[model samples]
Each structure stands twice: as C-alpha cells, then as structure tokens.
Target: MKVQYFAETDTLYIEFQDLKIVETKDLDENTALDLDANGRVCAITVEHASERTDVHRLTVEGIAA
Candidate 1:
C-alpha cells in the first residue's frame, strides 16, 4: 500500500494494490475510486485534499506482517 500527496494539485492518492485500473468511479465531485477488472477497489483519489483531509498527518496501525 502507498499514500501520496501532491502539493501542486492538492490531491491525495492512496493505493491499496499495484493493479491496473480498469475503471474510475466518481464518488463525488472531489472524490473518486479506482477499480480493477474484477471490480475490486485498487485505489482512491481525493481532490482538494488539503481542504477535506489532514494531509500533514498520517498514521497507520494494525498492519500484519
């Protein structure tokens, strides 16, 4: 998994899988979900992320090895 914040675009992208995105579904004007061919979510993109999320802070927990 990976998380990236693009300062120039104020966009936040979180990738759960390194899979080819077959389709993009808009959750709203500022949010979108990327799916693979099997229809499983591969990633999520948030526009205007600075306004909607706390981009300065990130925390991860309960990750299993």
Candidate 2:
C-alpha cells in the first residue's frame, strides 16, 4: 500500500494495489474510489483533503505475499 498527498490540490490518494485504475467512482464530491478493469478496488481519491480528511500521520502494518 502507498499513500500520497498533493499539497497543491490538498487531495489524498491511497493505493491498495499496484494495478492501474481504469475507472473512478465518486462517493461524494470530496471522496472517490478507484477500480481496476476487473472491478476490484485499486485505489482511493479524496478531494479537499485538508478540510475533508486528516492529512498528517499515516501508519501501515502488514505483510504481502
């Protein structure tokens, strides 16, 4: 998993898989989910991140096989 934040747009993106997203579905004006061609979630996008979400401090813990 990887997390990226764009200070300019104040948007946060979290990628769950390495697959490239083919489509995006907005949950709301400020949040959206990304899916791969197989319809599996590949990533997430959040707009107005500064106000919509906490952009500071992220922790990841897991093992991928």
Candidate 3:
C-alpha cells in the first residue's frame, strides 16, 4: 500500500494494490475510485485534498513485520 500527496494539484492518491486500473468511478466531483478488471478497488483519488483531509498527519498500524 502507498499514499501520495501532490502539493501542486492538492491531490491525494492512496493505492491499495498495484493492479492495472480497468475503470474509474466517481464517488463525487472531487473523489474517485479506481478498480481493477475484477471489480476490486485498486486505489482512490481525492481532489482538493487539503480541504477535505488532514494531509499533515499520517499513522499506520497493524503492519506485519
């Protein structure tokens, strides 16, 4: 999994898998979901992320070593 933030576009992208995105579905005007061929969610994209999310703070838990 990976999380990326683009300061120039104020976009936040969270990728749960490295699968090829077959389709993109809009959850709203500023949010979108990326799905693989199997209809599994591959990633999520958020526009105007600065206003919608707290990009300054991030925490990860339950990661297996």
Best by lDDT: 1
> Model 2 segments beyond 4 Å from truth?
63-65
The lDDT of each candidate is: 0.98, 0.88, 0.97
Clashes of 1: 0
Sort by TM-score, top down from the best: 3, 1, 2
Global lDDT of model 2: 0.88
For all the candidates, what are their Cα RMSDs to the real structure? 0.6, 1.7, 0.6
Cα lDDT of model 1 by residue, 3-65, tens digit: 999999999999999999999999999999999999999999999999999998999999989
- Write the residue-wise lDDT of candidate 3 on 1-65 in tens digits: 99999999999999999999999999999999999999999999999999999986999999988
Backbone clash pairs in model 3 (N, Cα, C under 3 Å; residues 3+ apart or in different chains), count: 0
The residue pairs in collision within model 2 are none
- Count clashing residue pairs per candidate: 0, 0, 0
Per-residue accuracy of model 2 over 33-60 as CA lDDT, tens digit each:
9999999999899988888776887766
Pull out the clashing pairs in model 1: none
lDDT, model 2, position 21: 86
